[model samples]
Target: MSSFRVKGGLKLKGEITPQGAKNEALQILCAVLLTEEKVTINKIPNIRDVNKLIELLADMGVKVEKVGPESYTFQADEVDLNYLDTQDFLKKASALRGSVMILGPLLARFGTGRLSKPGGDKIGRRRLDTHFVGFQKLGAKFEYDSKQEIYKIDGTNLKGTYMLLDEASVTGTANILMAAVMAEGQTTIYNAACEPYLQQLCDMLNRMGAKITGVGSNLLNIEGVEKLNGTEHTLLPDMIEIGSFIGLAAMTKSEITIKNVQVEKLGIIPETFRRMGIKLEIKGDDIYIPSQEHYEIETFIDGSILTIADAIWPGFTPDLLSIVLVTATQAKGTVLVHQKMFESRLFFVDKLIDMGAQIILCDPHRATVIGLDRKYPLRGIRMTSPDIRAGVSLLIAALSAEGTSVIDNIEQIDRGYQYIDQRLNALGADIVRID
Candidate 1:
């Protein structure tokens, strides 16, 4: 395994371009299975998760070719559905949650799909009931073997109907959307996840001749079509990375510019950061954050304590709560962070607390952080990453600490972020990869 050795107290400056969204790229790659013609995807991030998905595609007899640095052409003229039942495929597929998305397209096209239990961040119990329930609504039947942890879904001629997801799961929404595109009739998805990732998926499906309305809303109306053609699409820039860079700039007192931020698609992210008094200048598609001496946390109108929480689309993203919590440590005030979606995600705050952060872990789901405000720079300490966001947040904290710090279990970070060390090195961060 590789680790990151970082020397803190460096002010990062320069312009860094955000890579393509990992979440969107994974689903988009799976969407290729819906067609036999060649589909070219531009701006695909070179991350471990994407590479794994590509390998899975190749294992199923789909031809995937790299046309450019961050581009791929996929043609699935003959997919080997039996590959889905292999041990090798199941082991790799269970490493990431996006693996579950293949169930929808596979079932719709082949009338059957077998998938092992999917895995990602072990934040909480992310049940697939919504996904299986939605699939059942589309005329699919599901059977699971407890001992093997394998799920089998079978259906014929998926007919569109109204589906009300129990919760707003991003992958669940995307899986159903991909299946409903080629169904027999109209499918109405209510309370669907409307995050930017889902929006990008919908737009790409539309470009391929799928009639989907409500791109950025909760109620999605998908008119099932008989067939879909191949088309070229570009993935959106990573908003989570944008939020991470904002935290990095604030923590290190650095001035950095992030390019191609897709300003219109950053729903409530910029505003939420602005609540921490981080000023941003949007120049066309770029975001500029000036060097900061101190950050101020916004309070309620009645002078009470302010709490920043995450909700569904149009609300703050739960994926960014870790970065936001880490950023608040360098700000000048206190803020309550409530992450409702995941249970154990807040457990990593103990590492920051060991670094001299004034954080009070209220419970498994909430934390109250009081900024040290440069009064005491966090001392470098050895830590292990628990998940993707926590891994990167620890790296950021290590980079802003007083001495050299070693972060192990960096494979978690590598799963999502593309060339993270190289990108941070380009921005003047002193980070090295060691085995």
Candidate 2:
């Protein structure tokens, strides 16, 4: 397990560009299987999870070519359906949470898809019921082999139907939308996920011949097409990473400019950071965050304690809550971080507490952070990364801390961020990868 030896208290300057959106990459890659023509994708982030999916597609007989830096052309015309039965395929598919998305395109085009229980962050229980149930509603036969921990789906004659989702799950909505695009009739999905990435996927599909209306709304109407053609798609900058950089700038008192951040697509991210007292200016498509010695958390209009919580689209993203929590450690006031989606994500607060942050773990779903106001800077200590978001959160904490900190299991961090240490180092951070 590789570790990161981070020297803390260094102020970072200059500009950093966020890589392609990881969440969108997973959906876009899976969409490549829906067409036989060449689909050229640009801005592909060179990260572990995305690369693993690409490798898996190659193993399944998809012809992949690197056209340029951060660009790829994929043709899935000769995908080997037989490979799904192989142990190698099962092992690889089960290891990536994003692999579950392939089931939709497979079942839609080829009428068969197999997958073992998918793996990802152990934040909490992320059930696959929405995907399977939506498939079943569209005339797909689903079966789960508990002994083998595998899912088998067959959708030879899928007919579109109207259904209301129990939860507005992003991946679930994307999976069902992909399948429904090839169904026999019109498919109306209510309470769907309207995230910017999902909208990008919808737009890309529309360009490829799928008729999807309600582009940025909760109600999505997909008119099934006979076949989809290949189209070019460019991924948006990762909003989560942009949010992380904003928090990093404030926590370490750095003046960093994040370039080409797609400010409009960021939703409530910039405003949320501003609510935490971070001063950032939006220059066209970029975000410029200035260094500050003190940032104060905002209170409610009624003079109540400020509570930052995650909601569906248009609300604050849950992925950045960890960064917000860590950033609040050096702010001027207290804020309650309520992680509504996952219960276990707040467990990382103990590590921050160990670093001298005044945080009270209210429960599994919430944390109350009493800002130290930078009066006493966090002292670095050795720690282990539990998941991807938590790992970055710890890294940010380490960068703002005093003295050197050793973080184990940095592979978790690498799975999401591309060359995080190298990029931060270029901006004056002292992060060394101890292999």
Best by TM-score: 2
Report the Cα lDDT for candidate 1. 0.91
lDDT score at residue 250, model 2, on the 0-100 scale: 98
lDDT of 2 by residue, 279-325 (tens): 99999899999989899999999988899999999999999999999
What is the TM-score (0 to 1) of candidate 1? 0.98
Tens digit per residue, CA lDDT, model 1, 87-159: 9888888887788999888876777888889988888888999899999999998899999899988877899
TM-score of structure candidate 2 = 0.99
Query: In lDDT terms, which candidate is top?
Result: 2
